[model samples]
Target: MDLDAYVVAHAHEWARLEELVRAGRRTGPESDELVDRYQQVATHLSVIRTAAPDGEVVAYLSSLLNRARMAMLGARVLSWRAAGRFFTHQFPAALYRLRYWWLGCMAANIVVSAVLMWWFVDHPEVEQTLLSKQEVDDLVNNDFESYYSEHAASAFATRVWINNAWVAALCMALGITGVGVVWLLFQNVLNVAVVGSIMTRHDRADLFWGLILPHGLLELTAVFVAGGVGLKLFWSWIEPGGISRGNSLAIAGRTMVTVALGLVAVLFVSGIIEAFVTPSPLPTWARIAIGILAEIAFFAYVFVLGRQAVRAGHTGDISADLLEDRVATQD
Candidate 1:
């Protein structure tokens, strides 16, 4: 319990551990010695925290152990094999597990958009109330169709990707509150319905579907996925089942972060479709077919590879070994 005496007694081992960590590369014997000293120092740090409660000594040991850990494990941080597992296993598994949430979100949003679009078309007065005649005329005659082709394809694609990724990230980031995700998705639904009804009313239905379907399918699906995952995150702590709420929230938060990383690539693909394929000179059917294929491929990724990964015990979390930094104290 005497912090000064304890420091003097164990300072030699801490010094040895530091020496091993600083020794460029390790021989087998030195590596063994480093491992032993690392464990001893960790024990000392814990005892100091619980028994002596010395801030300065604890801070020093914590930093030393952190460096020791990186020295031991840093070489394996970047590996193609790890990346491969992440995409094929971790990402897909998370998708599979969260499929119900996202799938339901996708379905509900589609229905809401369709129904709202129909309502808007049925009640043309609502459009007039919202937009003046000049605005409506401009949107229908030009803006609706020209929007996709207005910008250079690559720049447009990047912009769309960044925008969509931001929305998805917002969903995951604010998922704990539950309201932000719903508000975001609702805003998206409102925008789509308003625009689609305008096109339909102005007798530009073909042009609208032709331009939108090619990219909208996949892009909207990605949005729905994010919304669903966000809602699921909110539910994790609320209905934690048998687990402690903190543990449930922690697990869901980790999973949300993992899924967010995967969604960047998803949003990028959708953005590419939106920018290039949507405005391309290809037949509308052909462009829409590409979008359908992409959407199908995403679903397949979730249901097929994702399911297999889940069966094999992947939960989209970072590997167990890396979570060693988490320490539990007495409850």
Candidate 2:
């Protein structure tokens, strides 16, 4: 049978059997019947698991966990709203969790960019060899700020976001292919080099302020989050430690939801600023200040605020709702 049909046909019986097995129920006729049903369902699920690779299974499982986590988070946040809480308590912990992936992505990107910058600095003529006349003119004339302000708003930005997001998702999905992480790192590094070249050519040494410092603080953060999610699955196969790859992937997959959700938030905010704010007529000082403040807020959310959510002790009512929801879902 198809998966949904198989699940529907035996889900109740399987659940009953699980409950009975957990409660130390013995093999009476009903128990035997439930056992038979459980075996059939288990066999089917096992076949499906075997046919799928670890990444697909982990992705499927992660999706389920993500839904549950989001529901729980939403309900809690809603309750906090009712009680007049500002709901900033969860951001810092989330940021802390994102740190691993961001650092990894950033390190790889930075090294490549630095090397390229050194090469270009050593060979200025190479710029003309590579760049087109228009590009060379812009770089030589230091006109990127105006160019960025204009192009960042064009439909090209949307296309860029979609294309980048698609690449990230595919890289994340392709972790099953064993080379997904490497592929992702290569693309990330290349992008960094290209951007760095432009910044260096224009002598905008404070490139962070104009090119990246504005919305980049968020956009790059999202990219790092995406890379981290991919690394989770990649590491499962490459260096799972003592655990089996499947189990390691499962564990990492659980955390991927949090990272992906946070990435979504980052992308949404970044896209808006990139489209309207980053490209517009803002003073360099103001842009730098905003960028710095935004980064600080981001760190505070992921590291400090997120950790406090579990212990904020708002009320037991929210906890009761959580338990009830879990029980209902399980039932």
By lDDT, the best candidate is 1
- The top-ranked prediction according to TM-score is 1
lDDT of each: 0.87, 0.57
Candidate 1 clash pair list: none
lDDT of 1 by residue, 154-252 (tens): 999999999999988887777789998888898999998998999898899999899888888888888888888899999999999899999898888
Which parts of model 2 have CA positions greater than 4 angstroms off? 1-98, 138-143, 151-164, 202-209, 309-331
Per-candidate TM-score against the hidden true structure = 0.84, 0.60
81-127: candidate 2 lDDT, tens digit per residue: 63343334333343454466657776776677679767776777776
Model 2 earns a TM-score of 0.60
Residue 209 in candidate 2 has what lDDT? Answer: 47
Off by over 4 Å in 1: 1-77, 325-331
